[model samples]
Target chain A: MKKIIAGAAYVVGDAIDTDQIIPAEHLVYSLSDAEERRYYGRYALSGVPQGQQGLPYGDRPFTAPNAFRSEYAIVVGGSNFGCGSSREHAPFALQEAGCAAVVAESYARIFYRNAVDGGFIVPFESIERLLERVRTGDLLEIDTSLGKLSNRTTGEEFLLKPLGDVADILKAGNVFEFARQAGFMPA
Target chain B: MTITEKILARRAGRDRVAPGDNIWVDVDILMTHDVCGPPTIDIFRREFGADAAPWDKEKLVIIPDHYIFTKNHHANRNVELLRAFAAEHDLPYYYDPGTPNYKGVCHMALAEEGFNLPGSLLIGTDSHTCTSGAFGMFSTGVGNTDAALIMGTGKIWLKVPETMRFVFEGSLPPYLMAKDLILQVIGDIGTDGGTYRALEFDGEAVYDLPVHERMTLTNMAIEAGGKNGIIPPDEKTFEYVRERTDRAFEPVYGDPGARCHSVRRYRVEEIEPLVAKPHSPDNRATVSEVAGTRLDRAYVGSCTGGKLEDFVAAANILRGQEVAIDTYIVPATTWIGEQLHSTRVEGDTLYEIFERSGCKLGQASCAACLGGPSDTFGRTHGSEVVISTTNRNFPGRMGSKQASVYLASPYTVAASALSGRITDPREALV
Candidate 1:
């Protein structure tokens, strides 16, 4: 686990559900096949509404070509991020798209757990004020050890709650790996 | 502690546990459907070694429900993978497709098979696993990874969640169903209100609801971010459970002074028919507010809305009338389909009533609910607007991303189908 992570932020509004993260139509692909699983990253955030003039990430698919060239390592969201469905593909798709973490005012319970258990991505809860201080493409630095987030572009800092045991799971790169290390399985 | 705490405490071998207390509890049953089963099997084999056997194969139930009926290769592969795994393990509870043991939806099948006993701890890969909570059990949904771990170990680590008690006072109105009550609650609390919390429903209204209808309340608990929605088992519950299985089990209830994080009261008399508008379950409004909203399609099925009671409600409205728009009716399970075909509403069978009304009857499965494949029967394509009895209305949840979905009760959907618009059930019922 990196003590401090710095990356570009991609901002989204409230209630971005799992369906929007990865649509159900794409759920047929088997993860056992690596080639099929990679399709998830290409389809990540493909369900997010496009051609909306005012919304963030509007008129653009999260998987659009060159979208990752901006290096969006963090996703900043409003309340109730990952609000619907229990599809782990939601976080897996985001992680596949090179998103290291998601910072939101709140998260749907299952998504929060999936992100932790699968070690797909780090889910951070912060105040709504952080939404105003951060912008898309802003240089955001997160210190997981200190529970602090700093926007280097704006020089604004926000406090995040400690990750506790979740940090350990993330460090081990998923629940299965952590289970093996913790003597839950034969290593 | 609340009933949820008590059950978890007992399962964890602790006299009592509070909210946020992490403990390992024995799982009585671990369920998986086609969409999630293959990955769970793959992961379990990967981590525990392919040659390693499951902790207890009898406790693991696999039902190939979601995409079994479809002809798509990828969708069919998931079932193949599950069938292969079940054969290798000689699992007793594998519900194979096209077999007499085939059950449709995992959640409904679990209940029909008598797996959801009182005081039990069950986990499934599907979010609606909370549907079993109607049996006075503590059940919730977990991801594939967790299901795999549970399959290998028969134990899961869980943090006990605080409880939210909803007390429904007074007799429920004739037109108001459990769907309305739950939609109203979700609308009031917002989708994330009950995040990581157990929602317990009790009161004269809940007690009066039949076990099947009570399952509807618990089924949508996940819509409000509930870890599980439970109702204390009474005579109705015992009668239902006993008919299915004679297994003696102790029912658990909240303490006389069990502390809840929040207690909310609803006067059933005041609740009218409700609908969760497009894109979000919490985006709710009165059916009257959106009345006369034209629809491209009407769907009546899912774990939340596809039960015997739901079919009866729809049949009551569609008995003599013909549908004005395209409509699809899917039973939650194969047993439910059998019930619809065998039982009569008025002089006509429920199946005949639906077919006579020009509704496309689908076989028992999660058809068009998860947007199935392109060939899925009655799946919404393009930018059509659909009024569905299914649980979710998330973007692209049913099929096309451009399709708009409005979720309501089966009665509301059936009535609306007759007029090709969103109509309040009272308009037809009264």
Candidate 2:
């Protein structure tokens, strides 16, 4: 796995829960065949406020139809990201949506584990200052090997926690795959 | 070491284990419900080969509770998948819907069926799997892949969590319930305060609470980011388990000098009814702080609030009074609904109370808690303001993003339903 990746950031506020990531009404699609699972990515941030008056990014959905062109490879969040529910679909949706990493001041424990176990996306823990240093469209660079996050746009840099075993899991493409490599599963 | 440490150390076959130590341990039971089960089965078949069988069929319990009663094709398909999987696998513990062997919510049904034995390590696909910890077991929720992995290997790797002790003293006030106490704790600790930590609840108030009420405390630990919430077993736990199952088990307890990461105390006498306002479980406030707020709906049901005692509390308030707002009452299990039909309080059965108050009674399943399909009864639609007994109040939790949800106790919800506003239960009790 490459230790460094850079892209535009999609910023969200605190306590963005599983319900918002993917509502229960859409869970049936999650159980469908592989082709249908893309709906999870399509509706990743469906619950996020869009086109609401007096909020940031008015009239623009978080992940618009042209989101691939916008290229939000990273998601930055405030405290307690993924706070409710143990659904892996939260991270699955983000991974399907082309999000490579999530940097947050803090995260719900279950979400962190699901991200690692599924090897869906990288989860980074940053200080509260990171939220202030980066904006929605800011080009940010994260280097997991060096535990550093550099803001390519502003030339500012911040520190990130090391990935530890999580990097190995992601390199192996998920826990089950890693288990097979480590001889925990049938060869 | 704390009780959690002791249990983990034993299961991992270690002399001593501390927080942050990752070790693989054998699981006693694995629970999966309709919504999460299909994906889990998919992963199991995909990863382990379609010809592979479960490691232990008896240890895997599948209950179709979330989308059972709904009319949606997809929702019903999830159940059908589970049913076919159970039939193919010959799984003995599968609780089918609309059958004599059907159970209610997986958490409560696990308890009623004696799967919540003390000193056991239980995992479920649903977040409220901590509800089993009320029986002195080490239980927590995991994602679909982890559940499927356990279904294949019957073992999982877990990082040991540090323990936080919360002691509650003094007797609870008449109107104050366990729901208020947990909401107060979550508010104080913030949503992520207990991240990767075990919450050990003790003290006079917790011990005095009924087993059902104690289950409420453990059930909400996940809301505070707890790995698991546990209560030491006592006579109440033993009697409850004995009545449900004849299985013999030893109870685990924390040592007197157990090392704790932090210790917090609360006085039950000083506590008051509380509510988690719209959009967040930690956005808590006193019922008085938001009193007289008009409501369009009042819902009482879920693993957190749909127990027999919860219905009894609401019945006490709605017996003679007519509901001013649309009220939905759902029992957590079929047995609870049957109890409502067979038992009477103050010469009026719970069914009669629902009839007299014009409340819509629902089957024993997680009806409106997860914002079921469009046809699901009592689901919030449009911009209606609702007072619910369900756990989460996040946007679109019950149904519509335009709707606002306030989480409270059954007493508070019932009282509010009577007046079409958020009224404290004490006023109704008076």
Candidate 3:
């Protein structure tokens, strides 16, 4: 049985980019396996203290640290999630940081395709329930195959159904492998 | 056939195509970058089981464009990993060459190096990859995984897009450049008007414009939700390719009888300085609407805005006046930077004029426009509004989430930097 080991959950506001997930200045480290925590820090509201109010930083629902600190199989976010360049680094960085999935209200088209192709799970979860059950650092178990998300804190279970072709890609371990099974290539 | 129709036909297995055809065609050329390549490579190798890689190494071009100029050690190491992978895979065009390192920016480097052949279909991992369409190729941006799959298979599928033709008939006004012209087009079409379509530019205006100017027109085609924007090959096209490449020239043109779904024309003299306000590129307003607005930073860099003509235009405007307090200008590519640095115009390079006017130059690599590590607006305590010469100005694109970014041409950005407020270059140009 394939299982999702939920870990720390780091919540973020809308409109995150690959550069903020990992700055362009960090492009030099493409080959290395080093980990980047708070890679999206520069673009975060709390990250830039002084200019916090001018942009839509304060009203964003995901700024609370305790909500994002948890280790989980799923990371939930607001609408228009990952809306910018087709940079694949955004989803890759999140998955590498121990996030098995990113459940958001919406996703940029390119980012959506890149995520599924990389074997990372990006599902659109209930923004309301996701905001309520998970806080930073609380472990939650998500079984996409089973479509269940359990909040360990309150013993609450949330239903999740993978939409579109994302579920198929995740099940096959990535797009290329799926292609191979589909006879896209000669063995 | 025109260069565009020829290229599309080669992929579509048809001599010609009309608008509104739902057809899947094969990608002609594919590209990737280091950031997304490693993972895609990992997936590719796993799926293929490593006995043999999927695609021809020569056809795959991978370079590190995002963090080529980095202060971070980790990011630098990542680049090294990619370099090693390129070598291991025997990828021919593996590195970027220039003063800060490579010739300048990747797209410009590719253009100058002649990797972009006319009538070829090009794809890359960055959205700005469409910049190459200036060379009269069908180029667009995709995800790393998509690129990796193409790397392994040597082919990918794409839905043939309907092409919308824009005909420009007259010469541009003294102050307006290609950037202004694109803004005018976008404003007319509105965002989402061309969603999932191709924009084919024609008429005397497009043919008369320079190569770099053509690039500016096509680069923003993505902003209009276009798959690829193209200009048919002509005498100018042949000249550009002959100068940069050794490949035997093959002239491609769209048939005069080639069917176009929609056609529209504009007089170049009718356009004005335009700006795409925050949140969307389609949210356009004339420069007159936003002029005199104070700015914290006036950036003139990015694939769309960074070019020799752009640099010359900005330098001409700021030649006598000093940049207002807190204004910064960054050239998009290192080659452009060096060109500006070593270039001698009136006893000085454009860099000299920019530096003398209280402005400091940032390196190439999409700096400032995409928000580099050191470049930020609003100081540490207060928020700032930036008027950039780049293509996009969506929220949080420049630096802070709170900062307001207004997109314009190099002329407008430079004029604003001089006057300490957004102003059209037409008013200040003599």
Pairs of residues at least 3 apart in sequence or in different chains that clash in candidate 1: A51-A59, B371-B398
lDDT of each: 0.86, 0.87, 0.66
TM-score of each: 0.96, 0.97, 0.79
Which tens-of-lDDT digit does each residue in B1-430 have in candidate 1? 7889999999999999999998879999999988888888888888788887888987888988888778899998888888888889898999999888898988888888888899889999888899999999999998888888888888888889999999999999888889999999899998888998999999999999988889989998998999999988888888778888876788988898898999999899999899999888889999999999999899999888889999999999999899999999999899999999888888999999999999999988998998978888768789999999888898888989899999899989999999999999998997
Instruction: Name the TM-score of chain A in model 2.
Output: 0.86
What is residue A177's positional error in candidate 2, in angstroms? 3.0
Q: Could you report the DockQ of all the candidates, in the order they appear?
A: 0.70, 0.71, 0.27
Candidate 2 chain A, run of 10 with poorest lDDT: A51-60
Please tell me which model should have the higher lDDT, number 1 or number 2.
2
lDDT of 1 at B65: 84
Model 1 TM-score relative to the real fold: 0.96
Rank candidates, DockQ, best first.
2, 1, 3
Ranking by TM-score: 2, 1, 3
lDDT of 2 by residue, B1-430 (tens): 8889888888888888999998888899999998889999889888999988999998999988988887788888889989999999899999999899999899999999999998889999999999999999899999998998999988888999999888999998879888998999999998888999999999999999999999999999998999999998999999999999887888888789898999999988998899999988889999999999999999999999999989999999999889999999999999999999877879999999888999999999998898878888788879999999889888989988889999999999999999999999999998
**Best model per lDDT:** 2
TM-scores of chain B, in order: 0.98, 0.99, 0.92
For B1-430, candidate 3 gives per-residue lDDT tens digits of: 4455567678677877655453335666566665556655655665566655647776677666655565556545556766777767666777652223354456666776677777787788877777788777888787767776777776654546677888888987768888888888877875545555678887787878888788888888877666678887777777877888886534456767666657888988777888887756777899999888887777777778888778888888888679885666656666677789787657878888888888867666665566545423222123678787787665556655567788888888888888889898887787
Model 2 misplaced stretches (Cα beyond 4 Å): A51-58, A65-70, A181-183
Question: How many clashing pairs in candidate 1?
Answer: 2
Candidate 3 deviant stretches above 4 angstroms: A1-83, A91-109, A119-173, A181-187, B1-6, B12-28, B49-54, B96-101, B249-251, B255-261, B341-347, B374-382
